[model samples]
Target: MSKGKTDDVTGTDTTGHSWDGIEELNTPLPRWWLWTLYLCIIWGILYTIAYPAWPMVSGATKGVLGWSTRANVAAEITAHEGKNADLVAQLLATDMDVLPASADLNRYAVARGGAVFRANCSQCHGSGAAGAKGYPNLLDDDWLWGGDMAEIEYTVRHGIRNEQDDDARYSQMPAFGEMLEKDEITAVVEHVVSLSNADFDAQLAETGAVVYADNCAACHGEAGLGDRSQGAPNLADAIWLYGGDREALTETVKNARFGVMPAWGPRLTEADVRAVSAYVHSLGGGE
Candidate 1:
C-alpha cells in the first residue's frame, strides 16, 4: 500500500528495499526544484566574484565589478541632496536681515535652526533656551545683548568669549570687589533685587539705591533698565542671568559674570547662521 510498492498486477520489480512488505521506490527529485537550487548556487558564485565577498591575508577580495557599500550609500545621499539643492542655495544667497517675516519663512528657519541649536547649543542653553547657572535664557524678552534682529545676528556671527576670533562679540563685566566695598555690593544687590519686585530690607534697599546709582548705573541704567550695547543686564526685570539669591549676587559682584555667546560665522554656513538668527529673534516678546 506504500507509494514505493511495485504494482502487483503488472509485476514491476521493487527498488530492492522493503520493510514489513512495504517496498521502496527509486524516486528522483523534481527537475525544477533541482534546477532552482543550482541557480541559487550559481548566483552566489557570481556575487562572490563581483563583490568584496571573502576575507584575505592583506584585505578582503576586490571583486571584479568594484562595487562598494560605501559607494552605494554615497550615491543615495547625493540623490537625496540633489532634490534640496535649490532650496539650500536660495537660503544661502538670501540676506539674513532682509528675510521675509512670514510665518512660513519663520517656521522653516526655526525648524532648521532648532536642529542646529540642539546639536551645538542645547548643552548650555537648554533645548528651550531656558538657561542654567551661567548661561542666559533665550526664551524671554530679556537680553544681555540687544534682542533686536540685527543685534541677535551680530551675536551669532561673532560669538562672545571666542578668543580665537579677532572680532568676537566681547564684553567684560567689571569686577566691583576692588572698586566697591563688599557691604556696598551687598547693598547694590539688595537694591537690584528690590528693582525686580523681590522682597528686600527697606533701609538696606534705600541705602543700596545710592550705591547702585554711583557704581552700577553707568552700565545698568539709573532705573536698572540695563544697556544692551554693553550687554548689561536689565535689573528691573524678573529674568535673571544669574540666580536672584544673595549668594549668587555676591559672587557676581565679587567675580563678575561675563557670559559668552559664541560666534556662529566661522562654524556654520551663512544660511544656517542666518536661519538661527531668524529663529532666535522669533522667540517673541523681545524688546
Candidate 2:
C-alpha cells in the first residue's frame, strides 16, 4: 500500500508507483498455482529417487525402484510375444504350402511377407517390387527360374550366386565365341533372332543349325525351349536377357551372359524365406 496517498473514491490504498496516473495492484500468487508448483518439485525429487538419475562411467545409478531401459524393452517384448502366441504357433505348426486359401489367412500371410520383403529384399527389389535394371521385376510374368510356388521357395531357400550356400542353384553358360568360328556365331545369332519372329535370312539360319546342335543344344535344347535345371532361357520367346535386338543376340553368342541373384537363406530365417516365396509367387505369375 502506498504510504503517501490513498484512493478516496474506492476507499483502497494505492500502490506507490503509477503509470500515466493509473495505479497498479500488488497481487499474491493463487493458492492453487502455488500448490501445483510445490507438487512438481516433490515429483522431481521422488522421480530421482525411484529411478536411475545419475550418470557414471560404465552405467547409471540403480535407484530404489531398480527401473532400467533394458528391463522396459524386455517387458515390451514379453508383452508382444504373449499377444502373438497363437500366430507364432500357427506359423510353426502349419506347413507353408497347406495354409488355408481363405481370404483372411492370405491377407495375413501377405502382410507378414511384405514386412519380410522390406527388411530383406528392398535393397535389390524396390519396396513395390519394381526391380532395378539387372534385377527382374516381381510384377512381371517373367522369371529366370521357374515361377512355380515350389520353384520360388527352392530359389529363396538355396539362393543364387550365394557362395556359402551349398545347395544353391548353379549354372554357367560358357562363352560360345571361344569355341565357335565367327561365321558360325553370326549364323547362330541370325537363327536366334529368327526364333523371336525377327526378320532373318533363311539360308543363314539353315547354316546356323549345325552350329546350334554342336554348341548350344546341350544346354538350350535342340528346340531352343531351354532347361530349368541348367538355368538356360528359352531362346524362342521375345524376352531377352540383354535385349531382343539383333545386336543383343550377336553379343550373346560372342560371350555367354551370366546374371546373379543373391541367396536370402543366410540373411533371413526359414520362416521369413517361406513368407517371401509365397509373396513373390503371388506376384501375378505363380502356378
Candidate 3:
C-alpha cells in the first residue's frame, strides 16, 4: 500500500489501498445522515432511561419517569371496579332465589355473568353453555344436579366431584365392570337404553331390569328416572352426559364416568358465582 494520493482520471483522493490496480475512494458520509444517526443513538439512550427497560433477575428496571404498563392496566381495572361497585353490592345483598324480583339487578347479573362464563366456564361447558361429551348441557332442562338458580349457585360454588372443596357435590358411580359380569353389564346397558329408546331389545332389557334393580336402583330410580339428590342424571331423558347409544351406555356401565368440576368458590368472588348462576339460569333451562 502507498500513501494517500489523487487519481488522475477522477481527480479524487484515494484511500491508499488498491486491489488488482483498482483504487478505493475516500468518500465521506453525508453530513445530514451522520447527524441523524447520532441523534438516533441519543434518543434510544434517553428512551431507555425514561421508560422500563434493562431486564433484571426478578423484573425489569423501573424508569426515572415512573411509568409502568402493568400499573396502568391495574389502575384501569380499579377504575372499572369502582364504577360497578354499587351494582356489585346490590347483587351480593340480593338473595339468588329472589333475584328475578328485581329486573334491573337480574339483568345486571346476567350480563356480568355472561362475561364471567366466557372467561372461566366456557372452557368446559362451551361458549353457548350447550356443553359437550362428558360435560352437561346448560341450555337443556336435563341436569345431573338440580337446575334451579339456588342449586346452580351451590354447584358453581362447590363444584361436582372435585376434591378441592369439602362441600363439593360428591358422587362416585361404581365401575360395574369390576363388580358385575360381562353378560350382566350388557343386559343392564340394554335396560338403560330401553329407558330412553323405545326400540330396545326386550329380552336383554328384561334381564337387565333384574340386574339394575339389584345394583342401580338406589341412585338411578327403579324407573330409571335418575335422582338429583345424589347428582344422578335422569336415564329416561334423551339427554345424556356421555351418550344415549348402546355402545356408550355399555362403556358407562362397565367403566363408569367420573367427571370433576373445580370448586369456583375459592377462585371466584361470591358475586361472580351468583352472576354466572343467574346467567346459566337465564339460558332457558331454569326450573
Candidate 4:
C-alpha cells in the first residue's frame, strides 16, 4: 500500500496520474457542483419517464405525458390555415379575369403566387422565371402562347402540349430531316437564322426561303412572324425559346423541337392556379 504523491510547489496532493512532468491534482469537486450533478441525473431519469425517450425496435416509448413535436407542428399548420380560410375562399371564388381589378386582392394573389411558383414552377421556369435552353423565359415578352392574365391563366390550367390534358395547347413542327435532304435542312436553318436578322449565308438563305414557304410558311407566316393562334413562335424577333444560333436552328429543323408542359388545373387548387397566373403576369414580360 503506497501513499499518494504530492506536488511540493503547490502543496496539493497528486492523483497518482502523471505523464511528461505533469501530475493531476486530487482536488475534491465543490459540494454545490456535486449536488447539482446528482440532481441533473435524477432530473434526466424523471424526464425519460415523463416523455418519449426510450427507443424500441418498432418505435420510441410513448411516455406518460404522450407529448409529440409532430402533433404540435400539425396543430400550428391547422391554425395557420384557419386564419387564412376566409381570404383563400374569396380568392377561389373570384374570377380569374377580374383578379387584376382589385388592387389588394391582386397584390395578395401575386405574393402567394410567388411562393407557389418557387415550390412548384421553379424547377422548369427557374426561380426567377428566366427559363432555360428548352424552357421558355417568363421574364421576356416572347411567349409561345399569349401573356395576358386570362391567357396566362388558361395556359397554366391547360398547359402546352400536355398528353394528360386533352385541351392542352398542342402544335407540332414536322422533322425536316425526315422530309428534306440534308442540304435542304441546312439551307432552311440558314434562312431561319436570317429571319432573326443574324448573320447568315445569303445564297443558302435565298434557296431556303422557297423551302420554308412550301413547308413552314403556312404556320410561320410569309415574313417569318409567328402565329399566336397556332402557338407558333415569331422567328423575326431576337428572342428564341430554343437558341437562335445556326447550330441550334439546324438541330431544331432536323429533329423537331417539341416541349411539353404539364397541366396544373387538375393538380393545383383553382385559387393556386389564379395566384400563380397573377404572379407570372407581374413579372416584367407579362402582357
lDDT scores of the candidates, listed in order: 0.79, 0.77, 0.92, 0.89
- Model 1: how large is the Cα RMSD against the reference? 8.0
Winning candidate number (TM-score): 3
Candidate 3: C-alpha RMSD to true structure equals 2.7
Off by over 4 Å in 1: 1-77, 102-105, 285-287
C-alpha lDDT (0 to 100) for residue 3 of candidate 2: 50
For model 1 the local lDDT of residue 82 reads 86
Per-residue lDDT of candidate 2, residues 150-205 (tens digit): 78888988877668788888888888889888898889887887777758889999
Per-residue lDDT tens digits of candidate 4, residues 197-256?
758889999999999999899998999889988998999987887888888888888898
TM-score of each: 0.71, 0.69, 0.88, 0.84
Model 2 TM-score is 0.69
Which one wins by lDDT: 1 or 3?
Answer: 3
**Candidate 1: clashing residue pairs, number:** 3
For each candidate, C-alpha RMSD in Å? 8.0, 7.1, 2.7, 3.0
Candidate 2 structure lDDT: 0.77
Screening candidate 3 with a backbone cut-off below 3 angstroms (N, C-alpha, C), the clashing residue pairs are none
